[model samples]
Target: MHSKTYILISFHTAELGNPDIVFLISIVLAFTFIMFLTCEILLQGSLRDHSEPNDEYVIPHGDWFEIVSSPHYLAEIVIYAGLVVASGGTDLTIWLLFGFVVSNLVLAAAETHRWYLQKFESYPKKRLAIIPFAY
Candidate 1:
């Protein structure tokens, strides 16, 4: 949906003659990619670390897990935000797409966090659902 929204907006706004807008898009894309990669790596590493044979589930630690229960979901939100920025930040469809993505991810993350708390006795109490410091 994010890619489709970006492509649709780009095609519709093909006459974007502002170099600053292009630069902003480029920077946003780069930052989004980096943030996504970092979150994914952290999530993957956490999963791998807990993949050992065990009778009980282990709460993932390290990286953003120290702050949020679902870093991957946060990364997903960041990706959609980047798409919105790349779509020139004024397209109603892109904004709606971003809002949808954010809402769904937040809901999923909140549920995951609740499950974690219920399933594990050592779950971090300070962690938010998805966003750091604020849910």
Candidate 2:
């Protein structure tokens, strides 16, 4: 992911000619750090509350789990979106990568949501697959 952002930066820099290196580096670093933190927080929250293998399956609660079936997947999409923004938001490749990530995660979240519905009749009817209030 960082590699792809670096490539986009290189392409953008080459086309624009002598863009501010410090500013670009700052943007990249900031986005990378945010992506790392967001993924850690959301994924960790999901995993921490997850049911143990021997335990009966239970729907997770708290954090973004209450809002969507797959908060971890949402984190992934956010990470890619941050990369796209860090890449100056004009690169075709980065946008395509973001689209790919979103599509795959959306599909996965939908499947997870379906599984939850099948497994537990008491699953919240208000919960969405991935996006909050919208799927």
Total colliding residue pairs, candidate 1: 0
List residue ranges in candidate 1 displaced over 4 A: 1-14
Among residues 3 or more apart in sequence or in different chains, the pairs in candidate 2 whose N, CA or C atoms overlap within 3 Å are none
In candidate 2, residue 63 scores what lDDT? Answer: 78
lDDT string for model 2 (40-127, tens) is: 7866676666455645655777778888998878877877877876666789999999999999999999999999999999999889
For model 1, state the Cα shift of residue 44 in Å: 1.5
Error of 1 at 88 (Å): 0.7
lDDT against true structure, model 1: 0.86
Superposed model 2: Cα runs more than 4 Å off: 1-35, 49-53
User: Could you give me the TM-score of model 1 versus the true structure?
Assistant: 0.82
Best by lDDT: 1
Q: For every model shown, what is its TM-score relative to the native structure?
A: 0.82, 0.68
Q: With candidate 2 superimposed using the best TM-score fit, by how many Å does residue 15's alpha carbon deviate from the native?
A: 8.8
lDDT of 1 by residue, 33-133 (tens): 99889977997798778545887667888888898999988898899999998777889999998999999989999999999989888788999999898
